[model samples]
Target: MISLRRQPMPSTRVLATRTNRKTRKPMQFRGASIAFTLILPVFLIAASAATQTGEEGSIELVDPKVLRVCADPRDLPFSNEAGEGFENKIAALLAQKLGKTLAYDYYPGATGFVRNTLNAHRCDLIIGMPQGDDIVQGTNPYYRTTYALVSKQGSGLETIDSLEDPRLKAKRIGIVAGTPPATNLAVNGLLGNIKSYPLVVDTRFDSPTSAMMEDLEGDRIDVAILWGPIAGYLAKHAKTPVKVTPLVKETSGPRMIYRIGMGVRHSDQEWKRLLNKLIAENQTEITHILAIYGVPLLDENNALLTQ
Candidate 1:
């Protein structure tokens, strides 16, 4: 959200010269044109200054003084600044290493958070950007996971591997709009038959997953595709005992495997490098962080990163 403004161009004047009747002085006109060219550099400098002024209060990661972080306020299991969520834990760890106070810019996990907050410099780092995404510069993935299709136990939809299975073609699958799992389903032409919801929903009960689980319990949707941690959590606590089936492969769909990583501005190479090093050094601690939230730690290639 760095604001930019264009500077006004320098004014130019035409010089009229009276020669012999119809003959005009080409040299005089050329000289005036050259003068305008000579003033162009000053205009360029002024434009740059204007741009800097517009971005005066914006956050910049190059500053070594503090580390500002952006996170979703309600996306638990991922982030919240109120001493909950895994991303908050990781951000604290990063701040501890950098010897700076952790400042958070909280926003709901919506489509605009990235463009409005993260890119605007409200925060210098985004804790859980999906790896390989081009919208933000992402670090090497620290964790990997597969989308899970959850259903009430013995619901006759158990042991499903692919969304394209004939049994699921007519069934309603609940998917969070704009998530990687939804995209995967769309790529495989499953979106037409799926029921989608915004990733962030108002809490109707204790955990955020309650509403979705209620829908499952009511038979509103035959199946639900959610991130691994969320699916696992619901499966562990649900009264109906939903089965969590990890999706590993599909022929024409989006890749079932995805890696999650931290995001920084592309210009913040130093910060990116430093965070990567920190992740590598604190592998064990990060594993513990994931375990706290029940996220599976996997190598960049989707293999297990820890025993």
Candidate 2:
């Protein structure tokens, strides 16, 4: 989930912010080390051959020295211009490893995120992207998470894990119109009974979770289903007490859980390899960062932070 954090004012990407979660599939690939285990030598050669990687020549290096990052200046949880997010921290770590200065190309994370930055050569990397994202050459996944079920702390629904919870049939729930959770709600015969929020939730102005929390606080809904990381973060600041739990065991076709990673230009083979190495080397540090942000992580067994 991408939360856009602004420097002065604040904006949030809500993670799956740029991703159409309802339609996009979870990223699947071998472990980080396995991703490049067979090509370590290839990477060594590429590294010696050139300091940069991407489509043939036609390059405009960002000073040919700094680790230029492409990111939304206001997105939080992921990145921001002020270098305040986890992605920013990871970028700093990468720069240290590369012996390069850290820089950024500020751009709103939307349809043009890649085009205006990484593709334009204004920056060399995007700190967060879904693995297997066709828009860019993504590194091996560093983390995996999922949507969550959120509700008032004292509400009888606090322990509810699935939409099939018996209580939901008679209560109003909040869900984003097109998110995967909505499908779960629909299949469980609750779609017609809940409030639907817009998918493009902007944290600076308003967000799906924020709006749902409002209704929740107002006693307008019984529960709110949101992406786990966003709900976990927002739930803490909510006016009323709330409970957040990963919806990992939800029975659904197309998995609700997704793995996230950093991305480079599609043709940047060497860049991709280097990032995989960074992720493999710093998985613990990255987990600490996400934990600080209240991101709820799940293991392959659907165990909490199961890594």
lDDT of each: 0.64, 0.70
Clashes of 2: 17
Per-residue lDDT for 69-150 in model 2, tens only?
8877665556666777678888888888778898887766655567767887778888877655677777898888777888
The window of 10 residues in a row where model 1 has the poorest summed lDDT is 12-21
**What is candidate 1's lDDT per residue for 1-307, written digit by digit as tens?**
1110100001111000000111111122457678789988986785566457754213235345677887666555666446687878988888897788888876544445566667776678987766766667888878777667888887888978777677877888887665556666776677777877653333322232456677887899898876676676566667787877766656664566667778888766656777899899986787788866656455655554442
Q: CA lDDT of 43 in candidate 1? A: 64
User: Which residue runs of candidate 1 sit more than 4 Å off their true CA positions?
Assistant: 1-65, 169-172, 177-210, 296-307
lDDT of 1 at 193: 78
Candidate 1: TM-score?
0.67
Which consecutive 10 residues in model 2 have the weakest lDDT in total?
5-14
Top-scoring candidate (lDDT): 2
